[model samples]
Target: MNLIFHVRSERRVTFHPYSSLNDYIDHACCFHCRDGDWWLAKSLLTGDEGFIPCTFVAKAHSLEVERWFFKDLSRRETERLLVAPANKPGSFLIRESETTKGALSLSIRDLVAEEGDVVKHYKIRCLDNGGYYISPSITFSTLQELVKYYTRTADGLCQRLNAPCKAMLPQQPWAQDEWEIPRSTLKMMERLGAGQFGEVWMGYYKGRQKVAIKTLKEGTMEPAAFLQEANLMKKLKHDRLVHLHAVVTMEPILIVTEFMCNGCLLDFLKTEEGRKLKIPKLIDMSGQVAEGMAYIEGKNYIHRDLRAANILVNEMLHCKIADFGLARIIETEYKAQEGAKFPIKWTAPEAINYGTFTIKSDVWSFGILLTEIVTYGRIPYPGMTNPEVIRQLDQFYRMPCPEGCPEQLYDLMMGCWKEKPEERPTFEHLQHTLNDFFIATEGAYEMQP
Candidate 1:
């Protein structure tokens, strides 16, 4: 079938004869090419013909294209999104049922709901005849049709579907060539660290350029799964993120990335030089991480593990987010395996209690990271055992501001630790806030001199 796809982002054809055509007609729909990542398409506005990257578009008719369709969204996440201060009573979205396979659920925000229950969900049933319905008497041929009907009249629903839950436009993956590197070109050097899966070593790419090579231990993880990390890294290209250079999938699988000479942020912060850095410099470091996370969030990806230990620092004190083994695409459902060990103090309550992870959970971890930053790498909730930390969190207890931490910075951290996930500021918001704070603090320090 010749499936239709819509361009989610504008792409400027900078090279070749196609550059002569109009800059990729905005909001254009196109057909996929038989081979490669190119698409054979015409602009919906100007009918201009050109080739576009397949990664720049999304399936036209897929539910994922709709802002309100949040596939695999958990019940708690839906509640949090709908209860946000900006949403109105009739805002709604459709998500795959968490309890039922091959089934969908409709969640709506209701102004009249009791105090504790502002969002309500209803099961959407599908018939063997390929029709969908929330009530037996209101079957529709497509989900779009059902939504259209509800938009005009509440009928059996709690309220009319006035608007889709606010969300960013979908982001497609990057189109790139194979990244496999010849094993003969690399010269392994000193070991950096060891983990449960494998060890990381300092290596030289092409015998001169520095790089970090992460090797996969045999029988530790499936090769395909390990390669998936490399594939994910390919799409995440940002200056503040550890850049992936190449991979060796041969006998000993290796992932090569840009080397951070200073090593992980946690260890660096505890060093004598690290402790001597002023608060403004620490804020600048934290802002760099926020900037990287903002990019990841915009692309609809979640870094499930966001802690100081996972951040790497360069010789210049610049920080970058590293370690993607626990990252996931927002659209996919993720559940922690039972009995699996998690970083209790660094994890959010919902994730620890129910195995649900979302971008909000990452925000919670960032709050804990702030405590580490101000204390020069002190552990979060020190003197408390894991079980004790959980018990305190259940009582709504939060970590206090570290000594010498600025009042404004502590307040921002508290905002990140809000009990409701929706109340946490997004990475983009946090980035802007921290950037502004850094500038103000730097100015104050200069004035004192």
Candidate 2:
């Protein structure tokens, strides 16, 4: 027989160019040749991005990489390299730009690297279902050459490369809307784990720095909620608050971002390995947290749920507060009116008793947090529930921060813990006070956590 046929898919059939068609399985770079009855196709459509080519070789192979080639990147062409559904540590890619035709070129690698300096090599993982990563060399010379070579290349080459070779999509916003992602981006979402909401994941935004995609978690909440928060967060520019990357509406949800790998402060503080909270680190992080809150407070934002869990810690042990889920503007008494429950001990006595919340209420909460720092995360009243904590608040229960913990911290905590709430220091005052205290202690205090 000249051809093999699926009795059902009898639509069309072609015979093999060679016997068995699978003999050269172990041969590397098999697709460029015709012997294997399979080939590597270049599609800008896959989640792996046009950063790498798709190897359709070794047909009938169960390896996820093999099946991926047959898929399409044409769907959701607007986003090529996804960032959400963050692939496994190893499942993604980055571009290897080289000089071709007196221009730079890029090749995908199997790892997202740590080095992105001019001479360093980097690997980036794809956010889609394709478990692919590109190990790219970060060479300034090569990157420059590629830019010179491809007049169309922008340092900010995003999903636009998948633009049809024939120029099928026009430049207008509406035209770009109907555009289909190229072959490379087609299979990007395949096998990708579902993201928080409709967020699509990608890497290398702004400066190719490692960052994370904040998407809406699927459930009863509308993806719009995430977008709303993302928008609000994007406008918030503070060194201490989590930096917002972009507020993109990927139809189903919005995306918020901050540097990747910097998990929340709770996870960070709990880790005992290779961690040293020099007084500087503590003061810096705590100070930043306070500064961030000050900024939010100026905008009338009340981070109703301020705690270690919402604050992120970078590699430098620098702190940046996040998670505005329970955050709100102080103009209204929304949650208070709804009788929504929140962390009890963290609540100001007024918020709990009088059902009133304001900037001062946030100040009171920060006081408890300052105490949490000295106590290393032990809640003020460890064994009490919200109702029980409320009882304690009524009695003006306060935790006596341990000795050997910085005395200035003790002073700050006590001031913020005042039951009257009016006695709590404002965020700005807290910042300046801490700064002065630290400068004076710089030459003194052993600086222990």
Candidate 3:
């Protein structure tokens, strides 16, 4: 397998694996993200006819090249990736037909190689409907060298993965000494939303793939705690949790994930009346949230940050739980003692004082999500501070459903906020109830109530 690396600078484009001179100059200049500033040219290797060339510049996306391309597959399946002779080592191939247009994703992963342990990764995606190219003769490189080439470039690169590129000269070939991706490279990384770790940016791994990169803060024991959460996310396999596409131990620490165009559910809730949603549609959307929550709880994981804002939607408005930085994995038979507390406004009363993290704690959070849906995505405790919300929880509190809130739905929320954890309904029960509630409130569907 052959892997091509692009060294972009204001001066010229450099080709690795030394392919044809014409193909080198003819950089298709494939750009990533929105601004149209990015571009990469691919060339078949001359030394090895099969491998192709693809470049990596910085962008708001694509920082997690390793995770975005290689982490999710089984070892056996990963080895099956038909790499071209010029591609990188330890990388796999993806057939175009395997993915969807709405979620155009491809990858190269599972490099067990060392530089003495250097693993080079490369990934490609065709812009138009022109089918994908899965080469067989690929080569390999190390992430260390790839990072060096990225830095020594010209004006650096621009963001906007989908941004149109200025047409470049036809094909040409050039090669230069290794360089670094640069300290300012952090400036080029795209913001990937936030979590307990801090804001994430899009970055590159082994000079390939478009991915959401997450960054966290520094403090005593913070790294250890962060890795614990990251490792847990790595081991998880539910469609509900925002997928941890890949994890890297790069110096400052970085995480890469699949980008979700719909932003977060908190943002979507603000537009409940938008064309993409109606009452029935909204209820169904909320149903997915419960389904995801139930899945996590089923695995004995407690989502401490269960709220509308923590939920995310993709281009199709499909809901997925996110921000596992505050999650806890409970043993199958685990049970907490008294005097434990979680998020009060979103937590069951029993959990607040007893430190109990039962599945019911999630149900309490789900109730708050219900109010968010009923109120067109309003915060559960509007105008209430953390202490104030806690004060209310101390009094057997529940946020009231809006004026036209359906009675059945109101009853369900009331059950969820019951002072005793045991009094809450299971997610499975609430899921069915929400469906029945939707059917009962069909008239409201048209009224936009």
Candidate 4:
């Protein structure tokens, strides 16, 4: 059997007499060729076969000089160099009469190669899995932007890229009909914030109901894992936990939940209201978070990222634990890859060095969160980078009490940050300690005001 391989010209070269059929060799031309440097090649484009220098052509390679299409090249020249004929699937071409090189003005005959009288041309905006134009007006400014958009939003690409987990995820009632929210009911408002795999938006549901819409930011998150998280979230319900409302199972996946009027706990503390925040209010907030975490602990769930940022607050100064994507449900210690990105300043020494995550490690993060509350969202380690913080922790260097921080609360923070994971106080213990403080101060606090 003759092996078929494509030949791409590295530079302009003339075909030898044995290969030439009165046709000149052009750049970016794809042709099937036999093995050998000076072998005969058959043009897939014009049905011409001739001997061409193998050194001049790259075998079955992508267009490396695509950057040149935007520089010093006319639209016609770009088409000639990079754009394959419409007959070729997965070929990119500029739209007719388009002078500016915008993603919206280009079309692709994606790998499907469907049969039709006129080949279907797909714009960058309409390339979603559902092929439904959610926003026809949105267009990428450049080719890189278009590439990025596809890399994240393409469901097929994301699945193929992300490695499958070794352990089988337990099946849950994730596909329940009542969990699905209609896409039309969600009116997206201002974007709240964004992370590696998702973006949060403050949205309105059913016209008047407020909700926080968490949407996957294209290719960042694995769909299976995302679904598992949603299912886990639905099963969990607590007063100090963020409430999940519904999930939109459409092209752009959305996880809708109750809107926290005050946003992230850390960000809120950094604002003017946080600066003037009373000790009683701070204690109340910390107690609430500890209560939520204790509930998670009871369920054998380890909240890996238990920092102030992952905690949300409401208008009434009520705090709730949020962002459980990194949280794990395990009986013992759970270890992850060593090089994975983790919150350095907030993590325990064991978690940072050995990749071990447990309830105790979460207690360590709770200590950091307490410091954040005391300092009104000031960073745990002042003027130290993550690496420096790690080095200091290794040397048993702990942060001193924040200014105006109560000595009793500071003692609890230190207990949570013990060198040995086993030595750290449990979330249940921490909650009781905070509750005692509040009870002792409530009469004084109330009488003073």
Candidate 5:
């Protein structure tokens, strides 16, 4: 069975049987399967068949890709969809009729493939009018191509996919890489936290390896977006950054990472053990966060949301930056999203007024995080609503330095909250300053008579 798939990237495929000059220059082909590293298929565009590489294409989900023509369906609803347009059979009879625009939908769950001697199939359907149809018989692998055939012009689907011309994928396909641990290997344990995106659970991998399991909230996000974020997170590595161990995409999407025993920094600080932490210890925690931020800054990434609640602490008192679900990669700068939500209390003045976000804005949030640490998890801009905090900041009001916070550290916080983005210190500078404070405090303790 030949199922429809879409080209994810542009590539030059070779025609082995017919090696004419014309065929070599513009051989067009839709993907079939892995003939080792090459594709074996035919192209509807040129009626030419050839071998393209696996990197050029990906399977497209029918509902999402065929939005212009088809809708999702369950088996029970198929008859209803076909008969809905007509009060009786005579007026809108779509089956075996011609020269009419009566459209009908069908839901089918047919066995489509065999993987390692196991047959599998996906639920799919098509939409059709009495005369014309939108299905595999139309001879287009993607909706973009199908639309182009009808209109004799490019359509929005082509623009939306934005297939790159170059082979921009990583050398190793993510599925076959070392990190792709089988879903069977993970055992779900106690629930840790719950949020809009998903739930976090303490889990065990391979019976002994403890890990944090984050499952995507059902129907909350598209599979493609979730997988994209997972891919990005797996590429990043650092001692102070949460390490992704594996991802399970079989049924309920799950992301496994190092389990931070101490939980979020804010909650940890509120605990009895947290209350006993001295200033030097707090500084160390902040320093670890800065080191992580430094790595992210150097990589030209923006963590849009950076607050104490997003920082995870381990049993060793090590802080690791977590929750990159909202993270974005920016080359030089990024424009603000039209309706993006942000934590107002921790947000910088510029990020609030304008929609611009930069590493400097993250610096502003880090300053607020410092307050959370110093105050032993006190909420920033306490006693003020979100709008009130914005108004106060506009009037040059700042949070009072947390009690017992050293003068040097408070001054550093003030610098981070500067109105001008360029005036704020880079994470590298913040890390060094924190190290100095840590060293000075240690020396003073040692000098006590």
Candidate 6:
């Protein structure tokens, strides 16, 4: 059977049967037939025949074949891409409307308006004739034709299409080069610690770069499920989140990430150096975690496990969110599988009762994490079991503020632990508030000295 595929990465044909043919570059298209783990294909662009690795390309058809089509982009992500510096006015992209199933949204960046660069979105309607139209009066048999027509004339749009928004390539795991590193390149050193699925080790990449390598314990989890975190990490890149360097998909399934010199926030807080940290410094650390969570939330992701143990600190005391094994993209109807374990103390009431996790649930966990930070790694609801904590929460009882914790900071934590999920403050708001608090606290501390 004939199949169509889109080349996601640059591939040099070094294997037999097609070694002399041209290399397949990013965004290239090909028609191919499956040959074991390879694609015996003819390039649509150059008509060159080759046996390409299955991992080098992804099966694509219809609207997905278009560079401007972003199948899974959310409205917020669409706006962010359009307004990016690399994309100029008239840059546009087509995405499936989040609110309307099967409908498409045409988002375009316009020239600077009074409020600055404005992004306008138009809905593309489909007629009974199978033609597409934005204004109903102008119709095209195919979406590609419509894009071509719009590219030439604005007609009744904010601006004529100039170019597709600069593609954010990192969202696709295969788009990254040298991401599947050879096992020989990594030199495993001393064991750092162990977790639910594996042991983490302090390793050296190429004998120079320090990295944290986590090895999967056999029979602990399915390989695909174990690599889910790596796949998610590949898409998310932020200063406040631990960076994924590479992964070994072979047996042992190693995940290598940027090494945090100071280790986990929980352990760090209990250390001598951590105990000496001032109130302003602690606030600054909390703000950093909030900033990272804000970025993750904005990207439509939820960190199901948002406890201090999952937060890591570098030598500079900069905190980053880590351990994304339990994280997932926010979806309409998501519930953890039956028998799946979750930290009850760090979980929200709704999440504990229904296994339903959302960004708001993460906020509740953040409040528990705040208690940990304030009390230097004290367990939440001390002297109470998980069931007791749940019972107390049902009675509308919240954790009392830790001793020496600032009143304003404690108030922020309480706001995060609201009974209703919708009543909780968003990570974005938390980040801004914490940042402002840190600035004020730092100024007052300086004045005292």
Maximum-TM-score candidate: 6
Candidate 5 to native Cα RMSD, angstroms: 25.9
- RMSD for each model, in Å, please? 17.2, 18.5, 17.7, 26.2, 25.9, 14.0
TM-score to true structure, per model: 0.58, 0.51, 0.53, 0.58, 0.58, 0.59
**Model 6 TM-score, 2 decimals:** 0.59
Can you write out model 4's per-residue Cα lDDT over 1-449, one digit (the tens) per residue? 34344443333334433445322334334445445335566665666666665433443433322321222333322322222221233334333234334333333333322321112233334454424231354445454454545545543221111110111111111123547778998899999898876789998876756689988766555667677777877777787899777887655688888788789998999888666666755776788889899999999998899999989976556688988777777878788766789889999999889899999999999999999998889988989999999899989999988998989999999999899999999999988788567445323111100
Candidate 1 lDDT tens digits, 1-449: 55556554444553222433244323646553534555556665666666655545666666666667787677645755675545778999999987778888888887652332267678888989999988787789999998999999988677799998754221112224437878987899999999876889999876756789988787755767767766876789886888777788775788888888789989888999777666756776788789999998888888888999889986556688998867867675467778867799999999999998888888999989988988999999999999999999999999988999999999999999999999999999999898778444322111100
**What do the candidate models score in CA lDDT, each in turn?**
0.76, 0.47, 0.51, 0.65, 0.64, 0.79
Error of 3 at 379 (Å): 1.8
- Spell out the clash pairs found in candidate 1: none
State how far residue 247 of model 3 sits from its true place (Å). 1.8
**lDDT of model 4 at position 63:** 35
Residue-wise lDDT of candidate 3 within 143-202, one digit each (tens)?
323323322431212111111111122222211121122333333256646655467666
Off by over 4 Å in 4: 1-177, 249-252, 441-449
**Candidate 2 lDDT over residue span 163-257, tens digit each:** 11110111111111322212221212122124233343434333323345444544625546655664565567675777665444544333435
- Candidate 1 or 3, higher TM-score? 1
Report the C-alpha displacement of residue 56, candidate 4, in angstroms.
81
lDDT score for residue 358 of model 4? 95
**10 residues in a row with least lDDT, candidate 1:** 440-449
Residue 320, model 2: Cα distance from true site in angstroms: 0.9
Worst 10 residues of 3 by lDDT: 158-167
Kindly list the per-residue Cα lDDT of model 5 for residues 1-449, writing each as its tens digit.
66555544433434343331122222334555655555566665565665544544445543232322333332212222222211112111112112223323212111113311111111112444323234334445543554445344222111212111121221111123546568888899899889767799998876756789998866655667777877887777787898777787655688888788889998999999888766756876898799999999998888878999899986556789998877778887777878877889989999899988899999999999999999999989889999999999999898877889989999999999988899999999999788667444322111100
